[model samples]
Target: MNEMNETGAHCHGDAAARVAEISGLFVSIRQILAQMIDGIGVPDARTPKTIIAKLSELQSAHLKVLAAEEAFHAQQDAVGGADTIDMETIRADIRGQLDRIRAAQDAGPLSGGAE
Candidate 1:
Protein backbone atom coordinates (compact mmCIF):
# COMPACT_ATOMS: atom_id res chain seq x y z
CA MET A 1 0.00 0.00 0.00
CA ASN A 2 3.04 2.28 0.32
CA GLU A 3 3.03 2.67 -3.46
CA MET A 4 -0.74 3.13 -3.76
CA ASN A 5 -2.32 6.58 -3.57
CA GLU A 6 -3.53 7.65 -0.11
CA THR A 7 -6.75 9.39 -1.09
CA GLY A 8 -7.71 6.56 -3.40
CA ALA A 9 -7.14 4.01 -0.64
CA HIS A 10 -9.16 6.08 1.80
CA CYS A 11 -11.96 6.43 -0.72
CA HIS A 12 -12.31 2.66 -0.95
CA GLY A 13 -12.26 2.26 2.83
CA ASP A 14 -14.79 5.04 3.37
CA ALA A 15 -17.15 3.70 0.74
CA ALA A 16 -17.05 0.24 2.25
CA ALA A 17 -17.67 1.60 5.76
CA ARG A 18 -20.57 3.73 4.62
CA VAL A 19 -22.07 0.84 2.69
CA ALA A 20 -21.81 -1.40 5.74
CA GLU A 21 -23.51 1.21 7.87
CA ILE A 22 -26.32 1.51 5.36
CA SER A 23 -26.68 -2.26 5.27
CA GLY A 24 -26.92 -2.44 9.06
CA LEU A 25 -29.55 0.26 9.07
CA PHE A 26 -31.51 -1.66 6.45
CA VAL A 27 -31.29 -4.76 8.61
CA SER A 28 -32.78 -2.83 11.51
CA ILE A 29 -35.52 -1.45 9.28
CA ARG A 30 -36.31 -4.97 8.07
CA GLN A 31 -36.57 -6.16 11.66
CA ILE A 32 -38.98 -3.38 12.45
CA LEU A 33 -41.09 -4.31 9.44
CA ALA A 34 -41.07 -7.91 10.51
CA GLN A 35 -42.26 -6.92 13.97
CA MET A 36 -45.01 -4.86 12.41
CA ILE A 37 -46.08 -7.83 10.34
CA ASP A 38 -46.03 -10.09 13.35
CA GLY A 39 -48.42 -7.79 15.17
CA ILE A 40 -51.01 -7.81 12.43
CA GLY A 41 -53.84 -9.43 14.38
CA VAL A 42 -54.10 -10.59 18.00
CA PRO A 43 -56.02 -8.74 20.71
CA ASP A 44 -52.86 -6.91 21.85
CA ALA A 45 -53.34 -3.18 22.50
CA ARG A 46 -50.08 -2.47 20.64
CA THR A 47 -51.59 -2.58 17.20
CA PRO A 48 -52.04 0.44 14.84
CA LYS A 49 -50.15 2.80 17.20
CA THR A 50 -47.10 0.59 17.49
CA ILE A 51 -47.18 0.03 13.77
CA ILE A 52 -47.29 3.81 13.17
CA ALA A 53 -44.35 4.42 15.45
CA LYS A 54 -42.37 1.67 13.82
CA LEU A 55 -43.17 3.12 10.40
CA SER A 56 -41.98 6.56 11.45
CA GLU A 57 -38.77 5.09 12.84
CA LEU A 58 -38.33 3.11 9.67
CA GLN A 59 -38.71 6.28 7.59
CA SER A 60 -36.10 8.04 9.68
CA ALA A 61 -33.71 5.12 9.36
CA HIS A 62 -34.18 5.05 5.60
CA LEU A 63 -33.51 8.79 5.39
CA LYS A 64 -30.27 8.31 7.32
CA VAL A 65 -29.24 5.54 4.94
CA LEU A 66 -30.00 7.76 1.94
CA ALA A 67 -27.95 10.59 3.39
CA ALA A 68 -25.04 8.25 4.07
CA GLU A 69 -25.19 6.97 0.49
CA GLU A 70 -25.30 10.52 -0.85
CA ALA A 71 -22.28 11.48 1.20
CA PHE A 72 -20.41 8.39 0.06
CA HIS A 73 -21.15 9.27 -3.57
CA ALA A 74 -19.98 12.82 -3.01
CA GLN A 75 -16.70 11.53 -1.60
CA GLN A 76 -16.19 9.35 -4.66
CA ASP A 77 -17.05 12.25 -6.97
CA ALA A 78 -14.43 14.36 -5.19
CA VAL A 79 -11.86 11.68 -5.98
CA GLY A 80 -12.94 11.49 -9.63
CA GLY A 81 -10.27 13.94 -10.81
CA ALA A 82 -7.38 12.03 -9.27
CA ASP A 83 -4.89 10.20 -11.52
CA THR A 84 -5.53 7.03 -9.49
CA ILE A 85 -9.18 7.03 -10.52
CA ASP A 86 -10.14 3.94 -12.48
CA MET A 87 -13.23 2.48 -14.14
CA GLU A 88 -13.87 0.21 -11.13
CA THR A 89 -13.83 3.14 -8.75
CA ILE A 90 -16.07 5.10 -11.10
CA ARG A 91 -18.50 2.19 -11.10
CA ALA A 92 -18.31 1.99 -7.26
CA ASP A 93 -16.42 -1.29 -7.35
CA ILE A 94 -13.66 0.09 -5.17
CA ARG A 95 -12.38 -3.14 -3.62
CA GLY A 96 -11.78 -4.95 -6.88
CA GLN A 97 -10.37 -1.93 -8.66
CA LEU A 98 -8.03 -0.82 -5.88
CA ASP A 99 -6.72 -4.34 -5.45
CA ARG A 100 -6.01 -4.56 -9.15
CA ILE A 101 -4.47 -1.11 -9.23
CA ARG A 102 -2.13 -2.00 -6.37
CA ALA A 103 -1.21 -5.21 -8.09
CA ALA A 104 -0.59 -3.40 -11.35
CA GLN A 105 1.54 -0.82 -9.63
CA ASP A 106 3.54 -3.55 -7.92
CA ALA A 107 4.09 -5.29 -11.28
CA GLY A 108 5.31 -2.05 -12.84
CA PRO A 109 3.67 -0.04 -15.62
CA LEU A 110 2.15 -2.43 -18.15
CA SER A 111 2.15 0.11 -20.94
CA GLY A 112 3.01 3.81 -21.19
CA GLY A 113 0.57 5.34 -18.67
CA ALA A 114 0.96 5.11 -14.87
CA GLU A 115 -1.73 2.52 -14.25
Candidate 2:
Protein backbone atom coordinates (compact mmCIF):
# COMPACT_ATOMS: atom_id res chain seq x y z
CA MET A 1 0.00 0.00 0.00
CA ASN A 2 2.79 2.40 0.92
CA GLU A 3 4.61 1.62 -2.31
CA MET A 4 1.49 2.32 -4.31
CA ASN A 5 1.03 5.68 -2.64
CA GLU A 6 4.65 6.56 -3.32
CA THR A 7 4.31 5.62 -6.95
CA GLY A 8 1.21 7.74 -7.32
CA ALA A 9 2.93 10.73 -5.74
CA HIS A 10 5.94 10.30 -8.03
CA CYS A 11 3.69 10.19 -11.07
CA HIS A 12 1.91 13.35 -9.95
CA GLY A 13 5.25 15.11 -9.52
CA ASP A 14 6.34 13.99 -12.98
CA ALA A 15 3.13 15.33 -14.48
CA ALA A 16 3.65 18.69 -12.78
CA ALA A 17 7.24 18.88 -14.04
CA ARG A 18 6.09 18.12 -17.55
CA VAL A 19 3.49 20.90 -17.39
CA ALA A 20 6.12 23.38 -16.23
CA GLU A 21 8.43 22.30 -19.02
CA ILE A 22 5.74 22.77 -21.64
CA SER A 23 4.85 26.18 -20.24
CA GLY A 24 8.51 27.22 -20.43
CA LEU A 25 8.76 25.97 -23.97
CA PHE A 26 5.77 28.08 -24.98
CA VAL A 27 7.40 31.17 -23.50
CA SER A 28 10.70 30.39 -25.21
CA ILE A 29 9.05 29.87 -28.57
CA ARG A 30 7.18 33.15 -28.28
CA GLN A 31 10.36 35.00 -27.39
CA ILE A 32 12.35 33.44 -30.22
CA LEU A 33 9.67 34.26 -32.77
CA ALA A 34 9.44 37.82 -31.56
CA GLN A 35 13.22 38.18 -31.82
CA MET A 36 13.22 36.78 -35.34
CA ILE A 37 10.48 39.16 -36.37
CA ASP A 38 12.36 42.07 -34.88
CA GLY A 39 15.61 41.12 -36.55
CA ILE A 40 14.06 41.18 -40.03
CA GLY A 41 12.07 44.35 -40.39
CA VAL A 42 10.16 45.10 -43.67
CA PRO A 43 9.47 41.48 -44.65
CA ASP A 44 9.64 40.52 -48.33
CA ALA A 45 6.48 40.64 -50.44
CA ARG A 46 6.07 36.89 -49.91
CA THR A 47 6.28 37.10 -46.12
CA PRO A 48 4.06 39.82 -44.68
CA LYS A 49 4.78 41.31 -41.27
CA THR A 50 1.17 40.62 -40.35
CA ILE A 51 1.84 36.91 -40.60
CA ILE A 52 4.56 37.06 -37.98
CA ALA A 53 2.43 39.36 -35.87
CA LYS A 54 -0.44 36.88 -36.05
CA LEU A 55 1.85 34.02 -35.06
CA SER A 56 3.10 36.03 -32.10
CA GLU A 57 -0.44 36.85 -31.07
CA LEU A 58 -1.41 33.20 -31.31
CA GLN A 59 1.50 32.17 -29.12
CA SER A 60 0.68 34.84 -26.58
CA ALA A 61 -2.96 33.78 -26.45
CA HIS A 62 -1.99 30.12 -26.15
CA LEU A 63 0.29 30.89 -23.20
CA LYS A 64 -2.45 32.82 -21.49
CA VAL A 65 -4.94 29.96 -22.03
CA LEU A 66 -2.47 27.37 -20.74
CA ALA A 67 -1.71 29.47 -17.68
CA ALA A 68 -5.38 29.92 -16.94
CA GLU A 69 -5.99 26.19 -17.32
CA GLU A 70 -3.13 25.36 -14.97
CA ALA A 71 -4.44 27.81 -12.42
CA PHE A 72 -7.94 26.32 -12.64
CA HIS A 73 -6.60 22.80 -12.25
CA ALA A 74 -4.46 23.80 -9.26
CA GLN A 75 -7.44 25.46 -7.63
CA GLN A 76 -9.57 22.41 -8.27
CA ASP A 77 -6.98 20.12 -6.72
CA ALA A 78 -6.47 22.40 -3.74
CA VAL A 79 -10.20 22.37 -3.00
CA GLY A 80 -10.51 18.61 -3.54
CA GLY A 81 -11.50 17.74 -7.13
CA ALA A 82 -13.43 19.55 -9.88
CA ASP A 83 -16.92 18.61 -8.69
CA THR A 84 -16.64 20.95 -5.70
CA ILE A 85 -18.57 23.64 -7.58
CA ASP A 86 -21.68 22.85 -9.57
CA MET A 87 -22.62 24.50 -12.87
CA GLU A 88 -25.70 26.13 -11.29
CA THR A 89 -23.51 27.82 -8.70
CA ILE A 90 -21.16 29.22 -11.36
CA ARG A 91 -24.06 30.44 -13.49
CA ALA A 92 -25.66 32.09 -10.46
CA ASP A 93 -22.44 33.94 -9.73
CA ILE A 94 -22.26 35.19 -13.32
CA ARG A 95 -25.87 36.28 -13.19
CA GLY A 96 -25.23 38.20 -10.02
CA GLN A 97 -22.34 40.09 -11.64
CA LEU A 98 -24.44 40.88 -14.68
CA ASP A 99 -27.23 42.17 -12.48
CA ARG A 100 -24.82 44.46 -10.65
CA ILE A 101 -23.49 45.83 -13.95
CA ARG A 102 -26.97 46.45 -15.23
CA ALA A 103 -27.92 48.26 -12.04
CA ALA A 104 -24.85 50.48 -12.32
CA GLN A 105 -25.63 51.27 -15.93
CA ASP A 106 -29.20 52.16 -15.04
CA ALA A 107 -28.06 54.46 -12.25
CA GLY A 108 -26.54 56.86 -14.80
CA PRO A 109 -24.05 59.64 -14.05
CA LEU A 110 -22.66 59.40 -10.52
CA SER A 111 -21.16 62.92 -10.52
CA GLY A 112 -24.62 64.50 -10.34
CA GLY A 113 -23.86 66.48 -13.57
CA ALA A 114 -21.29 68.67 -11.79
CA GLU A 115 -18.85 68.01 -14.71
Find the candidate with the highest lDDT and give its number: 2
User: Candidate 1 regions off by >4 Å?
Assistant: 1-4, 42-115
Compute the lDDT of residue 15 as modeled in candidate 1: 71
Instruction: Quantify all predictions' global Cα lDDT against the true fold.
Output: 0.66, 0.70
lDDT of 1: 0.66
Top candidate when judged by TM-score against the true structure = 2
Q: What clash pairs does model 1 have?
A: none
Instruction: For model 1, state the Cα shift of residue 34 in Å.
Output: 0.8
User: What is candidate 2's lDDT per residue for 25-81, written digit by digit as tens?
Assistant: 766866775676566555567877787677677667667756876785686468763
lDDT of 1 by residue, 64-113 (tens): 76677678668766766434657455556777788898998899756687
